[model samples]
Target: MPYVPPPDLATLSLPEIAALVAARKLPPVEQWQPQAVSDSLMVIKADGRWFHDGGEIRRPAMVRTFASLLWRDQAGQHWLVTPFEKQAIAVEDAAFIATDVSEQDGALAFRLNTDEIVLAGPDNPLTARGDAETPALYLLVRHGVEARINRSTWLQLVELAGDDLCLTSQGARFSLVPSA
Candidate 1:
């Protein structure tokens, strides 16, 4: 997708921008072959803060806009891909953070830092690293991209964990720990 700034960005509300972002179709980055590989100073920290040139990107709109253009190539490399250009960026961890969560209609829904909503299920399954007491939780967001579930959200999910270490969302039960 091309990075076209909205003409009235100053006037457009966050929800409006989010709607536009959600409505746009991303380009087939896998098919794009760019000869120039430029180094981007942008880095997504482990806590999901985006930094550029050693400074935090304070604008949520800018961060969310850039996030819409993010892509991961088959070679396991991350890039900010556009129709006309591609730049490599650094990711200390997952590119996004699930900052809030709620249970609705028997399913758990998460609100990402980018202001996008994702439901936990087979398509966006939850996974954990480390042990039961101190697990690092993650939720798949998009094409091979994931968001780290923040501590609060993880705690909420933990409360839902059953005796078998399984979580039920939207009537589907998912095992948080491997069965013996």
Candidate 2:
């Protein structure tokens, strides 16, 4: 079997979330309704440096990562749009996809729109520009673990920790820590 992501998130409280997930009160694909003080379509991290492995100096880059966000809202499904502006940001996104290259042809591979992609820039994120602290909800895609990225050329990723899929965006790694 392969990895599958959930499709729903219910409520946004940390402890309650943990409990519901642990107790299996929610389904694998439950909708998490979280209230954000800002926007949820985008999340940008502070500026950082992307360096070469051999002590070489590349241009510094920032971080832009998002998860379970809706960029486009259509009749039922929405089209995602990424806001990454730097080549470096694209590079990192591509790398993440590259690592998860799927040999199942196109059957298992996937592409991320804005929900799973982020870009970095020189300036800091303003309130209106949108940051990770924005209001957003989670919709667990209750399908078999599938490759969330494709092509591996320019990708955006937010690898979160999964304690039953408790996704936290405001963190060093923005990882989804298991909600035990």
Candidate 3:
């Protein structure tokens, strides 16, 4: 069946967005304990582009499949794992990009580059990094993997934030900018 992207987040309620997030069944990469570690020669650029060797991975399906298999180790290394083997992949910034965001009820919903929906809350909290002059926002995806909020999405989040520059979702509060 052809892939049908989820409807606009503005039209979906919090329950509906949560349902969309729950529907995506990602691979259990953490369960795979493959000892064979090798380099995958793949690099995820800061702009959310995936490149293998020297060529860009153009197929969206292929990228999504690989993304499903991604796992980040405790050492902050990115890997593509299977039951048989695990391969290291370089990441310039983050594994995924939060291409869009929406406010629903009292929660924040983010749409990743892989078309995955992530609802910000306690389990998947928002974090701010970088220096005070240049703040970067990240959303915990799964198993230590994070999606960096892109420029446009960051702007949207800023607009959604309160005058104190804080955004609250699911009882969790996050600062839009890094505190000095």
TM-score, per-candidate, Cα-based: 0.76, 0.19, 0.96
lDDT by residue (tens digit), candidate 1, 1-180:
645444343344445544654675655666676777787889999988999999999988789878877887677677887666789989888888998766645566777887766677777788777776566778877766789999887777767776666786656666665333
**Worst lDDT 10-window in candidate 1:** 4-13
lDDT of 2 by residue, 87-179 (tens): 111122112221221112111122223222121111111011123353122222222111122323212223222444232232212222222
- What TM-score, to 2 decimals, does candidate 3 have? 0.96
Best by TM-score: 3
Once superposed on the true structure, which residue ranges of model 1 sit more than 4 Å away at CA?
1-35, 170-172, 178-180
**lDDT by residue for model 3 over 1-180, one digit each (tens)?**
787888888889999998888888888787789989999999999999999998999999999999999999899999999999999999999999999999988999999999889999999999999876789999999988999999999999989998888999999999988877
lDDT of 1 at 92: 88
Candidate 3 stretches with Cα past 4 Å from truth are: none
Clash tally for model 1: 0
